[model samples]
Target: MTKPLKASGFLGLATMMVVGLYQFTLLAGGNAVPGWMIGGHAHLGVISILAIVMGFAVPVIGVTGRLRTAVTGMFIAGQWGIPGVVWIGEGAELPFLMPTAFLWGICLIVSMLIMLYATLTQDSSGIGGEATGVTPADD
Candidate 1:
């Protein structure tokens, strides 16, 4: 659960950072919230969950080499890049973020599907395989 812990922990930290930032906006500017703030808050939860899921699946799936790299990139992009783009788009008043969002969504979904497939199909080392030094007798 180390990877999951780190992923979720970072998400928690990011959530708190947003909380403080929004509070600052409220105090200094008075009731004017940037769309990016809302977007970041909204998307971070989804991304965080995705990250945690990936973290858990990583060890079990035993992904290696290029597949690992691809999955990692997709997960990170989905978790951070997409929402960050929205945040920037809102902040900079860019209208082209929609296409980027779609692309990111596709990347995220594909990564999730791959993770799912791998997790479902991979051979589980099973409980105390190390202790017994045998393949899983059964699920």
Candidate 2:
């Protein structure tokens, strides 16, 4: 497990806890949520899952060092902030969240492109060390 994966797992757990807290509050006779509050639910569930999925995917792509760091930071922020912006903008009514979210998304895209380029251009496959002219199992 990589540092990023651990972080994402924590975020996923946090997201779940937040959702549970909301439900518990409602069950306890807390005020009913406004329709706009639904964004929080989507963020907590979808965004968190996306981050967790990317966490596992990172290893398969063989990200490491500074590149890993960049990918982790961008992906984590982007995944969470994608929904976070909606919460901040629509839920909290903050106008600035959109720009912040946009920046995070851009960073995430760059990191993804970098990961794709590196993974494609470089043969991180261990097979190169062993035998040549042999294709991958799935291939």
Best by TM-score: 1
| Backbone clash total, candidate 2 | 0
lDDT of 2 by residue, 99-123 (tens): 7867867966886787787678666
As a TM-score, model 1 comes out at 0.70
lDDT of prediction 1? 0.68
For 82-139, candidate 1 gives per-residue lDDT tens digits of 7767767777778687568888888888877776766666677741134755677686
Alpha carbon lDDT at 124, candidate 1 = 74
**Root mean square deviation (Cα) for candidate 1:** 6.1
lDDT of each: 0.68, 0.69
- Give candidate 2 misplaced runs (Cα > 4 Å): 20-32, 127-139
Top lDDT hit: 2
Model 1 segments beyond 4 Å from truth?
Answer: 1-12, 27-29, 125-139
Give lDDT: candidate 1, residue 135: 78
